[model samples]
Target: MSLVSYTKALNRALGDALAADEAVCVFGEDVGAGLAGMTLGLQSRFGAQRVVDTPLSEQAFTSVGIGAALAGRRPVIELQIPSLLYLVFEQLANQAHKFSLMTGGQARVSLTVVVPGSGSRAGWAGQHSDQPYSLFAHVGIKTVVPATPSDAYGLLTSAIADDDPVVLFAPAAALGVREDVTAPLGPVPLGSARIRRPGRDVTVVAVGHLVHDALWAAQELAGEVDVEVLDPRTLYPFDFPALARSLRRTGRLVVLDDANRSCGFAAEVLASAVEAVPLLAPPRRVTRPDGTVLPFALDLDRALQPGRDQLLDAIRSVMA
Candidate 1:
């Protein structure tokens, strides 16, 4: 029974994966120095051979990981910033991601890319602060964003062990989040949605760090309007069954998402809900403005992000 932070849980997962399998290796910028903090002490324990630091080339290193995966090696790539995914989009989407189907299942890309400090961070500016998980999910890549430390450890372990390319987005806003733990945390299967807060009025589906905000908002709304918080941990292969069950219990739906409002993950979830589950009222989504690009100003950044008030209003709207 002990408390664990989200970052620590991620570090523990990487450590466990490296220790359990000889074929597992880590590659990324400044990984040897443990710059991202998720690989802290891993280089010393696993040595330079496995925890090797890569050059400042996201595309090259990602391609190398793809090649290694094809040759029967499991590689974990640590991208320090969420925006760096854009640099290797072709390598991931066209090459590694396509190998399995393009070759008719003879090859595999067993690589796990961990984006530490993802999503909007205070004053990280427009370039550094981007929550691009929706892009990967839209392109048919497996995407995971766990809200709790226990879930972080469990899902990361599962991602590293899976025989396909997976992207793990650890939101910067939730990095400091801690949880009191007692049981031995184990692998949480992908595509599973967790009901963080149960209610009868409206079902609220939240993503990444926004899940915490949804839970807090639900508590604040209390007797005025009961709100259920559903964390769709895996966005690509979303937990439709869980969403359907929640929708059945509560006739209203509200999605609280951190991404931009246009064609975003929130929109997709609401669209799916209305089509798959019968709702007494119209489903609503609270998200950033359309074509939103994070601003350099701190206050402007905060204004552009989704918060408790937005979730509360969306919940109330759905209920009304």
Candidate 2:
């Protein structure tokens, strides 16, 4: 088996999509130079037109992508940072995302916005470290967060192929993750959750990079607590049935999320799961503090983000 890193898998997915569809094109600030790593070497292979680099303007370029999508082009916008989502929120939420619903499915905007390194990147404090996938999910837009290398490949392929506006976030922490591959990578459905580890004690639903933290906490507490790890590959159009099935086996729940505590992804998961399934104890969620703005100091940054320790505490609380 060959080892494939998460970024490489994403690159492969983008390459495959471009090769398969003549209409597929990419727009971003430094995509041609491939500064984000996921678009590395793509420009040289796909030609300048297919992998066009844009001026340093998220609003202008994202608007261009929206227009291109409306005109029958499958444009993938590669965002260098996650916070750029805020800059283009009006364009994404009001313009691109609304086309289909506003026209009653008559319009199709096959646009894919990919944030290669989302969430906290050590020193990339405040503006750069936000994990806002939950915001897109809240607004009824398709939102995906793949945890592993293979899932990264599959989910991204599916996102690019989707006939609507889809936002895919590759957590900063998960980028370095590598996996052993024995089979070909392909598309994973937009709204499916994967059971990373199965157990009977409690179900710990993790989003994006926090999946690794959940797995680690589960292993660390293996003897005392039988923790189950569920990765919600897609946040919006969430696979509630999968979560329901897991909750059937384990009567407790805990969500490990990287976003802020109030109205965050973790909050949504906890609220939805409690109503759908019966649980043994009160559900708990471990997340960044509400209104948390990550500090530039490495220690402070680590402190602000959810970690395995917090996950373990939440899991144990749910089991108790």
Candidate 3:
């Protein structure tokens, strides 16, 4: 039990998994050298064979992971940048994702791709600031966006242990979050939601780092409104039942997501809530603009992304 940073939690989780399972392996750019903070010192600890560094070809290396998975090895790929996900979409979506279903459950793609810094990272701008967790969720692949140091550790551990390919988006905005570890945190079940702030006025469903932002907004509006903040740790296989319970209690919903609005994950949550649960008013969502490519300018970047004020406005609108 100790204070742990979000990134450090990830490092510890990977380290623990590598230690526990002889079949678990890590392959990525600069992973051996620990260029990505999450893989820091892991290569030397696990050895070169298990934590192998690959070439610059995302497609090739991703296919290699699928091959390893087919051969009964658990592979974890670290894509230094979020946008690199687009490069291996074919390998991940078409091949590894379909193996088990195509073969009638004869194969298992026990693979996990960890994106250390997802979403807008200050000056990273367009190419580097992609938050594509929705893309994976849309394709039926397991996707997780952990917001807390503990969740980051627990979810990643679960993803690595799952018998499927999982993409983990470690939000850049959430990497700095530190939590007091009073006890040993265990693996959090996938498709579960965490009630960060319980309230009676409204249910604010926040994804990834926005969970923290939602908490902040809830505190700011403490006396005026009781805003409940819910974090859906795994975007796909969403825990709608827990959300329904919260919505039933609050009678209102607001989704705060980092992706673009059109066909975004938040839109799906809002639509599903109205269909499956009772709501007093139309659900609201605070998200990036449709067809948006974030600008590099500091002000522009902040303007394009969802923030606490947006969550506050959305919560107020839903209550109205």
Q: Give candidate 2 regions above 4 Å deviation.
A: none
Candidate 2 C-alpha lDDT tens digits along 1-320:
89999999999999999999989999998898888888989999999999999999999999999999999999999998999999999999998999999899888999999999999997998999999988999999999999999999999999988999999999989999999999999899999889999999999999988888888888899899998999999999999999999999999999988999999988888888888888899999999999999999999999998888778777777776
Candidate 2 displacement at residue 98 in angstroms: 1.0
Relative to the true structure, how large is the alpha-carbon lDDT of every model? 0.91, 0.92, 0.92
For model 1, which pairs clash?
Answer: none
How much is the lDDT of residue 98 in candidate 3?
A: 98
Local error of candidate 3 at 159, Å? 0.6
How many residue pairs collide in each prediction?
0, 0, 0
Evaluate model 2: give its TM-score: 0.99
On the 0 to 100 scale, the lDDT of residue 96 in model 2 is: 91
lDDT of 3 by residue, 66-116 (tens): 999999999999998999999999899999999999999999899999999
